[model samples]
Target: MELIAKATALVGGTIAFVRRMNSPQQQAFGTAPEIPEARKQGIMTLKMPAAEGWKDGHLPTCAPGLKVNAFASGLDHPRWIKVLPNGDVLVAESKEQAGPPKTLMDHAAQATMRRVKAIGKSANRVTLWRDTDGDGTAEIREVFVENQNQPFGMELVGNRFYLGNTDGIRVFDFTVGDTALQGSGEKLVDFKPHGHWTRSLLASPDGSKIYAGVGSLSNIGDQGMEVEEGRATIWELDVASSDARIFASGLRNAVGMAWEPVTGKLWTVVNERDGLGDETPPDYLTSVVDGGFYGWPYCYWGQTVDDRVPQDAELVAKAIQPDYALGGHTASLGLCWMPEGTLPGFGDGMVIGQHGSWNRSKLSGYKLIFVPFKDGKPSGPSRDILSGFLSEDEKLAYGRPVGVVIGPDGKSLLMADDVGDIIWRVTGA
Candidate 1:
């Protein structure tokens, strides 16, 4: 028994060291790593945190001059958040579903996914939380929108409430202070369903058009590009016509997006394809341009070609390099900007919610990072606003940070903890 235990320990140690032989996150941040000699892999690394909930009354640690509290708790699987005009906050509770595996590699990815509690029955709802007395805690709460299909993003335009679900976009007529979502909603676009899931929606500044990003059906277009007809692309949807057109192409998974305050250009935090080794292809934050392409299965981080796909010289040549790299496999998801001098200390930059790393042996994210924007361009090192979600021993996860937004009052910050099943509020001390 002693000899067997020693053998197991040795194997575990070996795997850990092998995983760390890559670029540090700092090397991947701001600029893409100069991996002139990067190794490619057909297999995805499976180093995930054990899904565990926080103990009662316990909370995530906050940075100095900031205090964190459970603004609301007891949620099913709160993944995304939207703040309304009347100080009401909407939280989307949803889960993902995957098709049966057709290959050994697919089966293995599914198995690792199960270990991370990545799939489950759809919650299919969005709930409203309101702090009526100007307090941080939500005193009134109710189910705002129910019977939805794995909804992930929400937007409000005029009297309409738009929701981005797993398979389509739903729109409803709503008032400023209504708690219940009354309208049945109209589908703006029907998607191919499942795979990467979670379509992110962002209404234009003028509110006449909505920009959305649809994730690919497969990680690296392994299931064939035919299934990815409208997938893996950003869409420009006209509100009046309900007409959707491809805005950009070749982003593997554009999960979170925002418009740069100065440049007014749309930006996205893209989850790049997996199976490339730890340092090969870095997940990036790029300013999206209409008709532009960022290579997914063909090329990565500019013209550094990924040998996984057939040579497409024309497509590779047109692929634009991302503005900044947010570290490899960081799973960066949320984006909200606070103009300079608007908020004390944290003025004039974007706050990104990095949901942590599952593929790296040691976690890379699991925190809210502040990326400073100087004169409309990302500059300087990223700062951690909140962290310590992993346990002291790093064996279990207390929570995973997902959606982040500047509070309705514009003084506080709100973050959705999907794994912890709660919404955390951060206010200045």
Candidate 2:
């Protein structure tokens, strides 16, 4: 078994190298990315940097005019962040649920994830971090909620605290100042669990509805479309009635979601499908329409048919082109609205945490980026807000960022680094 795993890893690396050599250096970003022809392989590319925690005082490299510090550390696999009304911060710390490997590729992935410390029993808890003295770092850390399914997204609307567990949305009664939840929460809505199991939650500005991002059960519905029902889409749940409906569809893994302050449109960062060329279909950032479809298995990048899934000509024609592309395999997650003046030199835009990639020869998106916006649309080139998550040779990763949220003071940004088990705070230098 060990020998087979080693061979699979070698073959995966060789495939990635060959693909990189054959493909042209095309840009996989911006309003219009150069989408190349697909280069499917029997075994997909699986290049991952071995995860290494930061040592001593090491920190991620902030872009010019910004500085970062550990807001809180020593927590279990922190993946999401939410700020409360009174400047308290909530962090959802969970890891990938373990499952038996069924194929050689699965075995290879499992081995790599184990090296990266990504495979573990989930902590299944949310921790509260308070910077009581207004310092950049949190002095108090407490487990605010515990003993739940793998929770990821969190939101508080009035006294109802909403948690997005892997299989459902749980609601708990709570007050603003309470440090811990008072009772066992009620499941407000059920969601399909496992396969791409992070359910991200975002409440409507009016507090009447909440949005949950449920990823596809399998890559391109290979597990059959029936199992994918209520998956691969953002669901809108009515807060009062607890009823839910699909808000948008065909987003393979829409993780981070935020409202664009200018036009009041919902925006999301999607992790596009892999196994295509190094930069075939780029992951995207787009304004999600109320009932829009951005082609998934049938096609990608607006009407370009994937040819892998059974053709859906009518659905392909209706696919909405994303507003902007982040890059192929960037895994852009952890989105938050950043108004002008929140960070020095950065105007109003969206901050995205690119948790990095493993399916490409050359790594992409191991950093936090900013997409400038004007009138609620992408106006300029994306810039790096924080980087140096990976070593210069790309063999070691210091951390993988996931969830990002603007601080309650509105002048700082807090990011969740799952690999480092730390919450990073960024402010003007």
Candidate 3:
């Protein structure tokens, strides 16, 4: 019976693959053939040397046309970053652990003797940096908050600073200009913890509600689909009422969300379900309509259903497919909609951080992409704005970009490089 089931699954998957090959969406699978190699051409390019404990103060000059500057460093796995109104930068440094070594030892002995060393004993905190004296270097460094469990996304709503941690949403009565963040915050929503514990939080434009991105509890539905209440969906919570409800469903792992400036619609970048193959399900960036269903664990990228899981034929028919599908396994993160009329070159653009790929055999997506938005929607193909974070030889990737925002200066772009442990500012010369 097991053999029969496996054979049936294989045949079904083959049929699905063939059907997808013939579809128009197949054109979206490969990288653009005309994408020129990105030249290093900016006034400055800042990098944090990873070898030096990934600390804040290592000054190094990059290739010509790139200037290297340093912000606050000495952080452990900093995930998401936000620039405040006062030009100070707030970074959420995630805690890190060294797991047991992969070696041939007595399994029982290894399990018993391995002591998991925790980094960031003093790092359950968010740190702020400011260039106080106008020397183009950060002079003031301070801790914003302490004892938070793996905080990721952060937003400023009025006088309150909202944070999305591994557990839930938290708020603090803090201002960007305040010297210290010493106030206790109210917990907005409590989420059940599972796989991929980091949650990305954003607020609606009017500050009436909060949007939290909850990733899938498992990779590709291995954890069983019955527990579907909190996994792989964005939950909308009322700020004043603290009432929570599902805003959209069927997303595998939506790590980033932003409010589009032109349309005021909620947009998200999703790290889609993986492990059918390297290129099975493409990661996506889409305008998330309220009450919309994006196919996950059941169907992906439209009508291609997963053969590993039994399909709900009724539900599959109702899922609203994504608007823009990025290439497979790109690990899309840190979405920001460029304010419509800000930059002249970019009429209205969507900037996405492609955190790069580890699951695939081939290296792809170690750069930032700019998707032009016409009127209020995505138009044309996404172009590479920042590149070469990875070595051209593909032997090493020095940085993984996780968060991006229009800098406080309103002309430059601020990006968080998690692996490189530096905040980079890209400005047009």
Q: For model 2, state the Cα shift of residue 319 in Å.
A: 0.9
lDDT of 2 at 91: 94
Per TM-score, the best of the predicted structures is 2
Task: Candidate 2: list runs displaced more than 4 Å.
Answer: 1-8
Backbone clash total for model 1 is 1
Against the true structure, what is every candidate's RMSD?
3.4, 1.3, 10.0
In model 3, pairs of residues that clash are 44-67, 45-67
Q: Score residue 266 of candidate 1 by CA lDDT.
A: 92
TM-score of 2: 0.97
Give the top-scoring candidate (lDDT): 2
Tens-place lDDT digits, model 2, residues 107-142 = 888776765677778999999999999978899988
Q: Write the per-residue lDDT of candidate 1 for residues 1-429, one digit (tens) a residue.
A: 234334433443356467667534444777535543555543446665667878866778777777888888999878899999888999999878777768765555555555446666778999999998888899998999899888998999999989999888989999989998996888889887888798789999999999888999887787788898898888888998999999999999898889997889999899887766665577788899999999976888888887777778999999999988888778888887866653456767878888877665556778888888888888877887788888876557788888888788888888998888889888777
Report lDDT (CA) for all predictions.
0.80, 0.89, 0.67
Candidate 1: give the clashing pairs. Answer: 356-366
TM-score of each: 0.93, 0.97, 0.79
Question: Which is better, 2 or 3, measured by TM-score?
Answer: 2
State the lDDT of candidate 3 residue by residue for 134-234, as single tens digits: 54456787888878877777888888888887778888888669866766788878876646666888889888888999988666676578665677899
Off by over 4 Å in 3: 1-69, 95-122, 134-136, 340-344
Q: Which parts of model 1 have CA positions greater than 4 angstroms off?
A: 1-17, 21-27, 341-343
